[model samples]
Target: MEPLIISTRPGVRHHQLDPVGPGLTGRVFAIPLPTTPLLTDALPYVDWSDAYAVLTPLGAPCRDPQEWAEAIFQGPALWVRALFGVRELVVRLVGIEPGGGHAFATVNWRRDEVLVGTDQRHLGFRASVLVEPGRVALSTVVQVRNRRGRGYFALVRRIHPWVVRSMLARASRTMAGPS
Candidate 1:
């Protein structure tokens, strides 16, 4: 998979970047969490947030945001699934719902996006896939409720970018099919 290019500005658009460079094939750009009304209404407060986007190919199999979100959690991103499994075990030991009571996470499907997340005693997180005109953006937001939540998120924040980038790249390629 192509590496993800980190963007400093939250308002940077995918088209603004040069994706035709030597190392940019199937590029996943780390963007700011979109301010779309749907996402804003769904997750009002965000403590920590990250988003990644990729160009929406013509006739891609997963055109809908929900479909892209599903592709990432369902199969395309194998490492994500493995990580979820470990999360399930750890959460279950603490009496939380195993796997957030849904596949990977609790899913709330919407017209242009699908929200997935879980609210635990320590923290709460919401992730969404937004289908824009020419790109698909995946975003995650976390709100820490307590000290433990802050400590937990501290660890996750370090690796969250790499994980989301990989998942976005894998799902994009899987939906786009053969070059």
Candidate 2:
């Protein structure tokens, strides 16, 4: 894949610079690649999928945005990883085409905090991944010292594993499909 061509302007965040975890120092988002484009290739770089599963956890949908936001404010919350199970369609992050043939765009998916590094430094956070078209969401997080001090984290962390496993049960359906 060609080097990701992202625009670099002061305070201008690109698709690669928004998925940053704030206040959740060391907190991670973990995703899995099933040897398919739907999940693995869709990410900027499958390497981003790497993470200490023991320390990182992810879930399907945010049960309560309010509650989930509170936890993120305290630390890092799991990001929803969606994979396409289209038996006939080959899904993967891709660049637009006009003259040159389409090519795969590398996406990183570590602990859900996908980071697409940037060549320029005069822009927004350089971290991102394309979950899907029109449904992509980049993230940025703050680092908090007392991650477990928040009530929301307490509740989610307590059931983080269960939630992740449960969510994994239907990871493909985590998101309500292309909108």
For candidate 2, give the lDDT.
0.26
Per-model TM values vs. the true structure: 0.73, 0.20
Candidate 1 lDDT, 1-179, residue by residue in tens: 44334443353222112233223546787665677665565544566666778887555444676667777767746677677668778766755555454534645767778788877677777788887666778887776788767776677676677777788888877777653
lDDT of 2 at 14: 21
Model 2, 1-179: lDDT tens digits are: 22121333233222221233322312333332223222323323221221111121243332322222222222222342121122113222221111111111223344323433322111111223333222222232111123222332234233433343333223323333332
Best by lDDT: 1
Query: Clashing pairs in model 1?
Result: none
Backbone clashes under 3 angstroms, per model: 0, 29
- Scored against the true structure, residue 130 in model 2 reaches a CA lDDT of 30
Estimate candidate 1's alpha-carbon lDDT, on a 0 to 1 scale.
Answer: 0.66
Shift of residue 20 alpha carbon in model 2, Å = 31
**Model 1 — TM-score against the truth?**
0.73
Query: In candidate 1, which residue ranges exceed 4 Å CA deviation?
Result: 1-25, 58-62, 90-107
Weakest ten-residue segment in model 1 by summed lDDT: 13-22
The segments of candidate 2 whose C-alpha lies over 4 angstroms from its true place after superposition are 1-143, 146-149, 172-179
